[model samples]
Target: MDSIQQFLPIIAMFAVVYLFMIAPQMKKAKNEKKFAAELKRGDKVILKSGLHGKVAELYDKDNSCIIETMSGKLKYDRSAISMELSKSLNKPEAKS
Candidate 1:
């Protein structure tokens, strides 16, 4: 009983950390993966490096894509795209 009591705080701390930090990170990663898999040609996106462009080509075999920017088309891994930023960029603004 005494040993369990001593370890209770540590266990609770770990639980709190998982709930507040680890869980959200895992969820975000899952959402990002789903976003990458759902990507298709002609969709606008923002890269992790801050470049904005439209998806010109999808290479499923390599998990990569070609983006068409104003300058030219560039190839990059799908994971290089930022799901949050891309979604925000594509979101329509309010009329008000």
Candidate 2:
């Protein structure tokens, strides 16, 4: 009746927002997860901590990666790796 009519617009707006905004974000996150799980050694990557390095080692069972930083090899969780870099982490290091 009247209550349903009044609430319909609000529900419609929520659905619209989820479809246009939230759903895409979730989909992108899922794809990112798939990418992260497939990471391997020597794959240049960008971490959530902003650490861009080549994956020197990957422990699949423990879910950790050894990143080659300027200082030395650094370890980080697989979840902390945000994305795979397009080029070698070393190539850019020697330039600067």
Per-candidate Cα lDDT values, in order, are 0.97, 0.80
Native-structure RMSD, model 1: 0.9
The alpha-carbon lDDT assigned to residue 56 of candidate 1 equals 99
> Candidate 2 at 16: error in angstroms?
1.7
Q: For candidate 1, lDDT tens digit of each residue in 18-69? A: 9999999999999999999999889999999999999999999999999999
* Tens digit per residue, CA lDDT, model 2, 12-91: 99999999999999998898778777887788778877877788998888888899987899988888876544334434
How many collisions between residues are there in candidate 1? 0
Which candidate wins on lDDT? 1
Model 1 lDDT, full chain set: 0.97
Q: Itemize residue pairs with steric clashes in candidate 2.
A: none
**What TM-score, computed on C-alpha atoms, does each candidate reach?**
0.94, 0.73
